[model samples]
Target: MMLDRKGNNPLLAIKFFGEGIRWLGNSKLRKFVVIPVLVNLVLYAVAFALGYLYLGDMIDRLIPDWLQWLRWILWPLFFIGFFIGGFFTFTVLANLIASPFYGMLSAATLGIAAGESATVMEVPWLRVVKAELRRAAYLGVRAILLVIISIIPGINVIAPLLWALFGAWGMALEYLAYPLENAGILFSEQRKLIGSVRWGALSFGGLAAAGLAVPIVNIVVAPAAVIGATLYLREIEKK
Candidate 1:
């Protein structure tokens, strides 16, 4: 996976996802995808339902009867609030619950990339689960800290952009950690390798962030992202 750590192909991140989807026809990889997809779908459904319901209630309460004329403003605000809230909440919760399985999927995909039989690769479920939780907790803490920063007065204006940057970087770190770990690389080394191709990782992660923001399409984003990150790692190794 670190064979070409310096290769900076910015499009590779997104290409991994596209190719991963295409690679699913291979059946073996598709098997790894099923559980994560199901998990995402269920989590996303519940998240969206609850988020919008809460958003609707909040809007109704906030808008005054005289402000009914501001329906246009309130409607868009409702949608924006729901999407933002649901995006982070749904993604965080889904990933947290499915962390171990995602590691398994990533390891299997790494096997496929190495031309090794997926069955031959022994996925340590316990280790993977613990690692995933740690990664998720790390991300969650950073996000919380950023949200806190956004609450500050002078810097509040750029908080959203800052959060987007964090989101993009988090996507890269989160997804890539799977294959890197499978290859026995340390998280510190993974960060350095990724930093060498920082822009490419950003492109990859930014695209992922965008995908996760979409409604129904986001259901497939998790597995697809893992596939893409795996493919991207393999691609770099060949360089």
Candidate 2:
């Protein structure tokens, strides 16, 4: 049965976020989250310091005083380092945050597709990462493409929107690929599983993009967004 797409189309997505958080809480998953978060924070700090130091020197030597006006445009552009810093931080952390959730989504998707309950472990980590490496690579490549496309003059207008959607799509693909890979599905085959339902999956990610925007809330929001994407996939598969 199709879910009614009336009223709070977006609000309904939040319910999935709540459910995901609740599941994580019950699963005592915070311990798993803590290590990854700390690593992310450290990596981000290092990237920031290095970026400023390296980029500052490069900019100083590269840009002449006659082009002082360029600083106005260029300084903000230098901030792209920070954005890249944040992107790598989130890329690693997002996979970590969604690790277990990925397993559940995988098992459920497998069951839905195969008509049998799929077994998924709770303490997912490097194992899940290994299993979904291909998915992660594909997502990373796609994200890079999106970034490249967004840099073009006219395309830059839609950059922000496309970036968000790409991120969300990456998360969904990672979550969906986890269990299927563990079940011995080849990476190419797994991509097809996700690719076949690509449109619905990408839209599911658009809903999670809001959570990706918050500051303090983003820590909590990122994981919840993955959960929501998982739920969204299951819902779509039922159709």
Cα lDDT tens digits for candidate 2, 72-171 = 8876886755664465456555565556555554454344334554444453466666655656666678778887888899978998877777776665
lDDT of each: 0.76, 0.56
Q: State every prediction's TM-score relative to the real structure.
A: 0.82, 0.58
**Which residue pairs clash within candidate 2?**
none
In candidate 1, how many clashes are counted?
2
In model 2, which runs have C-alpha deviations exceeding 4 angstroms? 1-14, 21-27, 63-72, 88-127, 140-165, 179-200, 213-221, 226-239
The sequence of per-residue lDDT tens digits that candidate 1 reaches over residues 83-131 is: 7776777787787677667777777777777788884345576776677
